[model samples]
Target: MIADAAKKLRENIQKVIVGKDEVINLTLVAVLCEGHLLLEDVPGIGKTTLARALAASLGATYRRIQFTPDLLPSDVTGLNWFNQKKQEFVYRPGPVMS
Candidate 1:
């Protein structure tokens, strides 16, 4: 059953990302293991495309964050701000929440 799902996901992602069977398989493994994947490579290598395709295949929301040395935790996890009109705090969700 899980294998079927993985195959389907791989096929669907392949419609958008080609010549990356190994990467896709590794990605499926990571997802099945509930682990994280770090894709580091040169530009225009379809890293982002593969990510988006995987998310789309799984019906998951995709959020892209430009990580930088100056990026803060709040930027990824979200932050709370006071809503002057409501006189209360409002939480704004960030990429990690997606």
Candidate 2:
């Protein structure tokens, strides 16, 4: 079942991405292994497109955060806030949680 799913995912991604079959395959392998992908390349290399394609193909939630000098860990991990009504700390999920 996983192989079939992976094949379908690859085919779906290929519709938007030309060539780079090896990269796609490795991405599928990484996903199947419960890992993440870190894409670092020069600008306009379809990195965001590839990630969006993979997420779409697998029906997964996708969120992208552009790192800047001022980006903080809390921005990705979220934080806890006090709820006045509830009088308790509420855990607010961040982009990484999605």
Candidate 3:
């Protein structure tokens, strides 16, 4: 059953992505294991497209965060801010929260 779902997702992603079964397989594995995927490669290699495709295949929301050397942890995970109206701190979810 899980394999069938993965196969469906792979096919959906393949519609937009070219020949990269290994990448798709790794993505499936990561999803199954509830892990993260880090695609470090040259630009214009379908990294962002693949991620967006998978998100769309799963009917999930998509958000992009440009990681940089100077990026803080709060930037990716968000931070609490004081809401003046409520007079309390509230968490603003970051891209990872998507």
Measured on C-alpha atoms, candidate 3 has an lDDT of 0.92
The C-alpha lDDT values of all candidates are: 0.94, 0.89, 0.92
The TM-score leader among the candidates is 1
RMSD of each: 0.9, 1.7, 1.7
C-alpha positional error of residue 15 in candidate 2 after TM-score superposition, expressed in Å? 1.0
lDDT of 1 by residue, 1-39 (tens): 998998999899989998989999999999999999999
lDDT minimum window of 10 residues, candidate 2 = 1-10
Error of 3 at 8 (Å): 1.1
Over 4 Å off in model 2, which ranges?
84-88
> Which regions in candidate 3 have their CA more than 4 angstroms from the true location?
none
Clashing pairs in 2: none
Q: What's each prediction's TM-score?
A: 0.94, 0.86, 0.84
Candidate with better TM-score, 2 vs 3: 2
**Number of the candidate with higher lDDT, 2 or 3:** 3
Which is superior by TM-score, 1 or 3? 1
Task: Evaluate residue 46 in candidate 1 and report its C-alpha lDDT on the 0 to 100 scale.
Answer: 96
Report the number of backbone clashes for model 2: 0
